[model samples]
Target: MEKKRSFPKFLSITLIILVVVGAFIGWKAYQTFIGPSVTDKEEFFYVHTNDTYDLVLARLKSQGIVKHPDLFDFAAKKMDYPNSVKAGRYKLIPGMSNRRLIGNLRGGYQEAVKFRFANVRLKESFAALLGNSFEADSTKFNDILNNEAVAEQYGFTTDNFFSMFVPNTYDIYWNTSPDKIVARFHNEYKKFWTDERKQKAQAVNLTPIEVSTLASIVKGEALHVDEMPKIAGLYLNRLRKGMLLQADPTVIFANNDFTIRRVLNRHLTIDNPYNTYRYKGLPPGPIMMPSIASIDAVLNPTDHDYIYMCAEADFSGYHAFAVTVAEHQVNARKFQKALDERNIKK
Candidate 1:
């Protein structure tokens, strides 16, 4: 009887030990899947194209995003995250669980980048801006912008294609292709030129691209928004009378020297198509991306007989306008004296 009692007691003890071990394992699994495994601070994780799962795990550990790498690895493998990794810029919130983080990453939830550009001086700079913002590099964007066939494919010529990008804030994905980026800008361009705007362009005797070209010159000339209309009017009058535009900004653009503060006689003789002095009318294309205010100014220019414009001698961001050559000479002299006094030689 004593031997029988001992055997039953031993079996009961073995059963209790197995139950305790199972309960402990269940608790560990629950904590790994449901408890917070991310760091206290929010972070960003990037998975580049062609990145391996091991690389992603290493980056997560290096970034200090995962508090328990071993536990995270166990959960990730169980959920098959290794086979479903995605490339993008991902936002990692604070105190997130391992299961939730892996789920978001595996599901390809990407955070958008806010893309904004204005006053870009050249296509190269524009390409560089795109490269810095997204996965596509400057070379890719440049190839698309410079390709005549690509430009023509989108109903634009290479010379005028720069005007297609309407400067504004846009929400874009980080991994967007270069072609898609250009397509997006083209769509926005179409939306920007409404029927009313087209009619206004017709009323001004200019096409949309031509207006954009003129608007760029006006934008370069005027530092104040209120002064753009008058400056645009002066140029329009010159264009109508078959006179040389003789815009100083065009000369600077032709020289390819944005640092030239004072336009000299030598800069006017560059013989480039962009030199308004040498050209009889508007330049071949825009010298820079024009702003919305500048574009509207060209569409609604001030009706006036002003034939010439010179920077004000008062050092204010304003211009002095005159209708006759004699009056223009006087204003030009005052501005010349001001430039001479400031020693702005170039």
Candidate 2:
């Protein structure tokens, strides 16, 4: 009887030990799957293209976002997520589970980059801006801008390739290729020229490029939007009367000297076709990337007799318009006097 009792007691103790072990294992699994895995304060993780699971895991550990890297590695392998690593910007919230993080990464969810650019002086600057916003190299982007053969695919030349990009905020994936980036610009440019705008261009007897060329000059001349339409009208009147545009901005553009504050007689002597004083009509392309407002100012120009414009002598960002050269000379003299007083000779 004593031996039998001892055997039963031993059996009961063994059963209790097994139950305790099973309960501990179950609790550990629940913690792995449902309990919080990431500590507070982690917000982002960048997994570069072609990053292996080991590399990403190392990165996660290096970032100090995961407390139990070993547990995560095991969970990832068990879920078959290690082989399907995705490249993108991922959102990491505090107190996230390993299962949730793995699933989020495996699903390939990416955050869009809010990219913007404007008021650039050259294609090189534009390229730099795009390079900083997107993933392309700045030099490669500038090269593509100047490549005529590549530009040919987009119906542009090296000279007019800059016209494709309009100033706006574009929400796009961070990894968008340079060609696709420019393609989106082309698409936006096309959509901007609506039927009404096209008809307006026809009424003005100008192609879209011609309109843009003139608009760029008007934009350069008039620093204020309110003055842009009048300046645009003055240029249009000059074009109609077979007179030279004589735009100072064109001279600066031809010389590739953006530093010219006051265009002089010497600047007017530039032999480049972009020099409107030397050329008969519009230049081969825009001197700068004109805003849509400026383009619309050209398309819907104000009806006026003004054929010339000089910067206001008051130093305000406005212009003085004149119907005759004598009146223009008077306005020019006032502005020239102001320039001399301010010692802004260029």
Question: Which candidate number has the best TM-score?
Answer: 1
Minimum summed lDDT over a 10-residue window in model 2 is located at 1-10
Q: Which stretches of candidate 1 lie over 4 Å from their true place?
A: 1-27, 40-42
- The per-residue C-alpha lDDT of model 1 at residue 90 equals 83
Tens-digit lDDT track of model 2 for 1-346: 4554345778899999999999998877766766688876566777778889999999988888777888888888988888899887777878889889888889888777878776777888888887886666788889888999988887777777776777778887766777787788788889988999999999999988788878888888888888788888889999999999999888999999889999888998879999989889998777888888889999989999998888899999888888888999999999999999999988
lDDT of each: 0.91, 0.85
Q: Evaluate residue 17 in candidate 1 and report its C-alpha lDDT on the 0 to 100 scale.
A: 97
lDDT by residue (289-329, candidate 1, tens digit) is 99989999999999999999898999898999999999999
Q: Model 2 compared with the native: what TM-score? A: 0.86
Give lDDT: candidate 2, residue 75. 82
